[model samples]
Target: MRFTTRVLLLQLSTVVAVVLVSTAVFIVLAVEQLKQEAETSALSIARTVAAAPVVRSEVALETSRQINPSAGELATGPLQSYALDVTGRTNALFIVITDGEGIRMAHPDPGRLDRKVSTSFEEALRGEEVIAWERGTLGDSVRAKVPVFAPDSREPVGEVSVGFARAGVLDDLPGLLFGVGAAAALALLIGTGATLVLRHRWEELTLGIQPEELVTLVQNQAAVLDGVGDGVIALGTEGVIQVSNNAAEEMFGLQGLEGMSLQELGLPTDVIASLEAGEERDGIVVGDRVLYLDSRQVDRAGQRLGSVIVVRDRTDMMELSERLDSVRAMTSALRVQRHEFANRMHVAAGLVEAERGTEAAEFLRTMRDRGPVDYPLAGADLLTEPFLQSFLGAKSMEAAERGVQLQLRDESLVLGEVGGVEGTEDIATVLGNLVDNAVTAALAGPAPRLVEVTLLDDGPELVLVVADSGPGITPGTLGPMPAAGESGPDRIHGHGIGLALSRDLLRRRGGDLWVIDPGGGESGRGAVFGARLPGVMFPGDDLREDEE
Candidate 1:
């Protein structure tokens, strides 16, 4: 049943039970009291009639005359007259006067006069008063009997009996019961009204949901929040955490976060700010993971409830995007190489058509020996690794297209196979971002736009250094650098996501990326970026074993 209905029914049943019990008790006690009052009234009237001077004198004379054989039948005229007067005035059921022998001297019924009394009268004749319920000639009654004494003697002359009928004694009981029942009913009605009011208050408190429905809602909420993969946190308008799912606790590396405020949770200031503003934030780095945050304000019935924040892990997504960018760069490089090769092939075919067969053959031989066109990079010959060579060549073509000089410094050297290095993709990411940034910076600067790259992979680590002839690092462009062994990216500088992501990747693999010389190079002042990937090569591993 509905919760409200159940409550009302229970309350009404209780009230009814109480009313019935109370009414029954009241009726019983009232009947008992009325019976006692009737007995007392009968006894008082009987005693008063027996004590009258005329009644005592007359009864004594009658008793004396009855003892004399020649006195004839003692006249009970006075006794009968007194009994009738008292019975008529008090509205008693019967008043009987009997002599000491238990013979009725006077009675309410004329036919019963001078007859033996039907009920016991031994105590009254002996001068002891008596009161009891008895069935006599007159019927059942609450009756009282008292002895009548001679005027000058202590001897009893007769007895006076007075009774109130049982029916008459209880005549007012029905009326009394009716009053009690009315009072009980009033109490029941009041109780029922109070119960209804309480039920309404309960509905308001529970938002009009039944007990069973409330339980189901709680169960469903837990299931849904716990079943989802994405982290969810619900907050009240005061910023207290009301609901935190398992995913949220795991993602934040916390437990028992419910009831804690956002500040108490020790979240990053930017994340808290975003939540407070109810704005969406994407690809924000938190701890060692990249997360996307979405905040939406919740409202119901035109009331502002709170805000819900959804946290989605984006670390893997960021890595995948980096890999796609690498593929695109490689594709661009292949396209450039294909166009260059086509032009060279056209030149060789033209020479053969001009009858310079020997010249064409020599050209093909030289081209085969040289292995593709040189882009005038000063230290490009030092790069023995094919992957780095091709990647740098592609970059060189790209820089040329943008009117920037791309070159490798003389210090660049690698005696090992760069392709076999652990975390090569991470290295590629760092190098690609640095090279692209340098090329862009150089192109934007004044005359002598140049971008120089240095690479070294000998044994223990792989090092990449890129310098651009652009504006040097300036203050207020970066936050504090992360300490060694710390997990997150360094605070953002003037450079955008490229530098941040590159630094993050390097640090995750036990490496570091930094500004070695904020580029005040002697020849051209610009920014210098460097990165070191440690443990890329294990001890005693030959760099050229695979090549051989």
Candidate 2:
């Protein structure tokens, strides 16, 4: 059966069972009360007749005679007449009077007059009253026997017995049962109506699903949502969080996130707005992780059913991409050097093969004097560190490819090894981004396109500055940088994450990136970007400082 039907039937059955049991109990109690009331009435009438002055005097005189009277002798006497009057008024089965010899003085039937009473009267003879159900000549009845006393004494002269027929005691029971039955019927009707109303409400709440099905759905949801590696969040149409997986909770650094609004969860306004607009956003940093967000509105049969968001962390992928770009740049630079060397080797071989020994000797001497490849940078020859030198050479070639000149400033110096810093990769990331942005900006300028870089390692800090010859950052456009690991608009360097990610990396290691000069003016100058890495101790710098 459908769940609604089962619920309705169960409720109705429970109510009917309760009403039936209650009705049975009511009937039993009502019958017992009726019987008790009958006994009380019988007892009351017997006492009243026993106390009558005329009946008492007649019985006393009869007892004094000590004679066994015959039937019809006192059939119309005062005692018999009084008993008949009492029985008629009270609707009793019979009222019998007996002398001290246990003979009936008056009976409902004249033939039974002056006969011994069938039921016991010993207690009544001893001045005690008795009331019980007993069998008599008339029939079984609730009978009461009371002692008759003389005019001035407490001694019993005769006894009066009042009996109500068994049928008469329960005469009102049928009417009571009918009333109880009516009440029970009315109660069952009310209960059934209530059950139907509740069933309707249950169907609405469960969306027409049974209790067992709801339980299974909950179990399946838990298993599927928690078993996934990617973060998942389900939102209601009002942008309230209804469900969140373990990955989402851990990624967002939250717990018990259900039933909270997106605003309350402290998510970026951009992210929330994007979700509300049904847009997909990727590489949005949340906490210390970069996450790619894919969201879609859920609808079924043209009904809006809120939305769901899936998140995948992209921090590792971004780092790998950066590393790959660096390697690719280095490889390109090496390939260029290899090509230039091969050309030089060919020239030398051709010179020697032509027997111009003096010219070949002079060429070899000149090649040793100048380096392998003639670096186009003016001040770049001052840099002796192999890694920084090679990295810059690669970047210079890259900048030249884009019609921008990359150079090292005359004052640029690394007193000690740049790689001795705690996070050299972070340093590389910061410089690499700064140079790339400078080159791009320079390429957009009027003439003399140049990106000048300076690297300095003061004892406790590593300072880097990259200046471009392009139109500088507009005034008031260089807003505060995004906090570490927090995603923001792509405003720096005209739509690239290089500056933002580079700044984030630097900030993670006690450093910061900032624009020193918003250089654009009537002169249309370029901007200057700088960074400072604190506590950047070089290898063996302590010994060098002690010697100094």
Candidate 3:
């Protein structure tokens, strides 16, 4: 059964059990109470009969006659009426007077008189009070015996026996039990039915998800998956294909791969082997592509079930990585070229030093007109020299082209003592993207545009601020802009893919980018992109010293 049905069954069964058990307990206690009430009534009637004036007066007359046989007053009309009145007033199943010889004398039923009863009259004659649950000649009865005595003698002359039928004792019980039991059953049925119905509705409600919402959710997830520039796939525990986003599908040249295995999907042999062995392998070669496959056993509650294989296509990333390696190679070549150019300049300077006066003056005038770099990297450290030189040069050229002034403050501030390789690279990327965005935004302004670049050592963190004077962004794209291709109308893709990529890359490296408070003016006073590189950016044992 479904979960809801099972839960409903358990609940209903519990309720029914409780109701039935409670009803049974109540019935047992009620029956016992009824029996006690019945016994009490019977005892009350017997006591009333024993204490009656008629019974006592009759006994007195009989006793007086035994003392004086000629006492005619003892046999008067009062004594005769006493016997009839005593028998008539006693309300019981059977009331009889028995003589000491175990023979019935006076009885409510006249036919029972002068006859033996279905009781131990001998036991009653011994002055012992007799009571028993026994069947009378009519029906089941609870019988009791009491001895009658003369007024002058302690010895018993006759015994009075009273019997109460069981029918009257249980007269109201059966109806009460039936009524209570029926009500309990009805309540059980109603409660159980209600519980089941609610459970069914809950089941239907959960499964009744709206198609539009599901479609929207799936579409959004698809966009996220496709925008990552990486391949992603989801697999069922059985190793059958569950979902393969377009990136993954395109990477492996898979067409409608709904039921294909890893081996069947033309994966690398090492990857297939590792998957079969249920181990993770990355940076493996598949065909002409170098990819990473992360395989892990899919388990729930510690039970090994199956596995999920995440295939990441590293074709473009690997190419970029190769290009970076090439850039490292070019670093040395550029250094050699700088030295060679420097030697050539020294030679030209020496020649100028020895030249005739007018020719040398014209050369110096030409050099003066050339002007200095807009954002010069002077007195920078060796480690940061190349990056600053390349990045600032590129931005400065772009700024000049767009008629935007790029001002670099504190360019002499040394950054070589900063933390690990990754940290410095992240700082560079952060500053680069911010300045690029600032220049681009400022260029959109009507008049002279300006991008202010500031770098500071704030004791614990390195803060870089890139603020622009421009049309600024729309109020909507104030914060970190959307992913490169994920911008809506208010957020247009800006400055190629550098801004979004830089943000993601920096975030992955344990840093972040944010916007500062606008605080006034139109366009929200243009945008201020700020980056705070944490203490982790500083290398071991490096501390900021007060400048000389």
Candidate 4:
């Protein structure tokens, strides 16, 4: 049988047993109470009869004469008529009266009169009243015995005894038992209903699973949570953490994660919201770690079991993706340079073949004077880092293709490469997004579409600014943007998501991105954005001192 069914049945049986026991106890007490009441009534009747002045005087006379009670003594004796009348009035089983010498003076059976009594009446003769259940010649009964006294003096006299039949004492037993049974049945019904309700509540809590099924479910959850490497967190509908695997503890650097809320976990705002919303998001910055997250709600049999979030540390992957983009861009730039070099070589060769030696030499001199074919940016010579040069070269080519001019501001200078492993990924991410945004905005503007980037190494911090000669930005457009997924192309077209993630990354390192100038859409000026990236410079590359 089902576990719930067995539990309910057991509870119901307990209720039935209790009710039956209670009902039986009540019925027994009821019979005893009735019997006691009958005894009390019979005792009162017997005492009243024994105290009568006629019986007292007559019994005293009979005692003085020492005469025997005659059978059918209706003409000679008041005792027999008196006993008969009293018996007729009260429904007692018998009203036996004994003389002082223990001889019966009156009895319900006249032929038995003037005979020795079968029941004991010694306490009554000694002036004590007695009430008890006893067996006599008539039958078993609850009887009362009392002493009859002389009218003139406090002297010993004959005794009077009264009794009620045992059957009569419990005459109302059937009705009393019926009432008790009815009450017990009602109680049992209520108890049964309560048990049913409790069973339903238990089933709901366990989702109607048996005990063994519950054990299996727990084992499966343990296996899955332990086997997975990605961080997994389970939250209840009320936003409390229900389960957090070991990977989650390690990933979030928090122990004892269960029973905590999102507020208590102290996760990044974007990450917390994404988890709460059960959405998929990537590139969330947490303590210098770029994280990707996917959250889904758990449901079973149409019941909501809250949500589960899977977290992956994507910091290394982001850095590698950036490196690949830089390589691809450098390769493209080199290819363009190779094609241009070949064209110049053809011109020089043709001139020499035509015997115009002076023209060929002049062309060669001009080519040398030009220094490099890769100066799409104004301050390209300032960047001694090969990665930065190639990256900027690629961005400039991209912007130019859309009719926008991209430039490295003349004041920008960097004496050493960007920071070491610590902040390298973060710096690259923020810088890439900012440059791409500036280029896109410049391309969309009216005329003189130009984008400028200024990078300065200040101590161990890289402070950079980007400005665009576009329609500019409205201050109101800035707000908390939602987090979104990022792909390999470096999130170029998604301005809002890119900007939000960039600001978040810098902020994680005690730096920030902000609007230096909200922009001038109607005026000739453009929008300027600035950022500070900490730990992005190799310590004591100390090149800021050179510019100073």
Say which candidate scores most in lDDT.
2
- In candidate 3, stretches whose alpha carbon ends up further than 4 angstroms from where it belongs are 1-31, 60-91, 100-102, 115-117, 121-129, 136-139, 152-155, 201-396, 405-435, 441-447, 450-548
Greater-lDDT candidate between 2 and 4: 2
Tell me how many clashing residue pairs each candidate has.
Answer: 0, 0, 3, 1
Candidate 3 has a TM-score of 0.49
RMSD of 4: 5.3
| lDDT (10s digit) by residue, model 3, range 494-533 | 5223444455555665556666643235444666666767
Error of 3 at 438 (Å): 4.3
Off by over 4 Å in 4: 74-76, 152-156, 231-316, 345-370, 378-387, 415-429, 443-446, 458-462, 470-527, 531-548
Pairs of residues clashing in candidate 4: 419-536
The TM-score of candidate 2 is 0.72
lDDT of each: 0.76, 0.79, 0.59, 0.76
User: lDDT tens string, model 1, 1-548?
Assistant: 78799889999999999889988888889999999999999999999998999878866776776453121132337677778888999999998887677677777877776677898888987889999999987788999999999887778878889999999999998889889978998999899999999999998766678999999999998897988899999998898999989888876668988999877754556668988899987766544456778999997666677999998887678777876776677677677667777888999999999999999999888766544556545567777565677677777877888888888899987766554544556666778888887877776567788889998875768899899887654433433343211222223222344565667787877888887766433545777888987766433335346446
Worst 10 residues of 1 by lDDT: 483-492
Tens-place lDDT per residue, model 4, 367-419, is: 67553355577667766655566567767888888888888888998766765
Off by over 4 Å in 1: 1-14, 29-118, 121-179, 198-223, 234-244, 264-279, 296-308, 325-417, 420-422, 430-535, 538-548
- Candidate 2: worst-modelled 10 consecutive residues by lDDT: 476-485
Report the lDDT of model 3 for residue 27.
89
lDDT of 2 by residue, 1-548 (tens): 87789778889999999999999999989988998999899889989888888878888888999566678786867777777888888899999998887788888888888888998999999999898998888888999999999989999988999999999999898899899999999999999999988988887666667988999999998998988899899998888889999898887788988998877765578788998888888767655566778888987656677999887777677766665676676677677777887888899999999999999999888766554566666577777655566678879888887888888888887766555533556655667778887887887787889999888877767798899998887543334443432435334355335555666666777788877876788867788888987665364454478779
Ranking the candidates on TM-score from highest down gives 4, 2, 1, 3
User: Could you tell me how far off, in angstroms, the CA of residue 439 lies in candidate 2 after the best superposition?
Assistant: 8.3
Question: Considering only N, C-alpha and C atoms within 3 Å, which residue pairs clash in candidate 3?
Answer: 419-537, 419-538, 419-539
